[model samples]
Target: MSDFMEKLRHLIKGGEGCIDHMYLDTVAKVTVGVGNMLPNVAAAQALPFLLRDSGSSASPSEIAQDFESVTEQEPAKVASRYKQYTQLYLPEGAIDDLLDRRIEGFERRLRDDFPDYDGYPESVRLALMDMVFNLGNRGLITKFPSLTRAVRENDWAECAAQCRRRGIADSRNEEVRNLFLMALG
Candidate 1:
């Protein structure tokens, strides 16, 4: 991964640090390892390392069933019942591996779906990747035709403004816009 990609992950994963276990995020998703969202118990199959460290001899299908057994609840409620209800755990490097996979998927989507992505500035690419990391898809960028066009034209200012116009607050949007400007400078 590029330095910019690391920086993007740092910015977005802010204060969360490197998580080494699975838990319920604020919105009730079974978030595991780092920011990997486990949409279903079957999703756990992707992290064999974590499963091995979970200390359970349960097969993948059994683990998926366990994951499915947890009721969808808020973070606090999940935390309260965590010890009694969940058995997910991650050893060192498991979270990193999962994050790497997620990042690779996002990069692939960015390269294949975004026109001229290879030719865009590093900052612009990183910003889009950051957005993809958060949104879990490149479709959000496609929703803003002006932003994509501005990026393709290498119009940093317009791209920044378009980022803000997407209803993101100025403070948060400025950080991303400034990244684009930094590359232009």
Candidate 2:
């Protein structure tokens, strides 16, 4: 259900202009999933595009100052808050890790389907890997027919259109759109 949760978060976050976020020291940055270029980007800029239509009441500097002092809230208090929040609000992304093997399953399935296009470009690979990571082997297998056809013919527009047809809402569709756009560039 992790994929489902990811899609749900995408919906909740308004989807557009979405970027992964992380804190680096006292600064914030947009995560490229592997890199961070804008280290000093304000929290207001770095935070994920959640459903908050209102702007920040405090300035970015003020927000950073508050975060700096946040440790004083006490370990137990913080722990309690975490428990309460998790129980009432936050998503629990904990996994079993029971079913994770070498992923020979994916390789076998991909070969059987998209026999051509033995590999993908780095950007395209990132997009495909993300979709597979989120959705798993079975999920990828389900879309084998259309995705395989697109890759075999090297029709990226059709491939992206196929991507848009699958996944919850347009969750994976955005990835396809961005991936093909970058591939063209």
Candidate 3:
């Protein structure tokens, strides 16, 4: 992975760490591994079976095995698993591959979705990806229209201001906005 992607992955991992067994997220969905959401687990593999479902039982060994396998799997499969499950349990194992694929995919999508994307600074690109990773593309696109416009115009100050106006804590907003400025310079 590129240096930029590595940095983004570290930031994402800061927010979404690895968990081996199945657990419930804020909305009560089954979550396992690193941020993998359970309902969509099938998309990860040819035999994408849930170690534990919302209403199913899973032994400790079974859960351990599921988590271990994720770590043991190849990079592509690991990324595929994460995308399908939303959480990938083994950070030590497949994180690099997962980050590479996820970041590259996001960059490609950004370029495709925005005509002005190619001219944006690398930091802006990274910030945009971070937003999508945290808030989803729809949230970035819909929740922060001014931020989107500012990004399109390469108006880093306005982008930072828009980021600061978010409902998230000031510290986090400041951190992200600072990242934008760092990229701008």
- Quantify all predictions' global Cα lDDT against the true fold: 0.64, 0.40, 0.59
Clashes of each: 0, 0, 9
Q: What is the lDDT of residue 85 in candidate 3?
A: 33
- Give the per-residue lDDT digits (tens) of candidate 3, residues 1-185: 56866677776666555554344555545454446554543433322234333423444454444544444444423233434432323334443554566667767777766778867776777667777766766777888899988887788888877875444556656667887888667
Question: For residues 85-123, what per-residue lDDT tens digits would candidate 2 score against the true structure?
Answer: 111111112111111222234445655655643465544
Give the lDDT of residue 3 in candidate 2.
57
Measured on C-alpha atoms, candidate 3 has an lDDT of 0.59
Residue pairs of candidate 2 with colliding backbone atoms:
none
The reply for model 3, stretches above 4 Å from the true place, is 40-91, 164-170
- In the order shown, the candidates' Cα RMSDs to the true structure are 4.2, 14.9, 9.1
Identify the superior model by TM-score, candidate 1 or candidate 2. Answer: 1
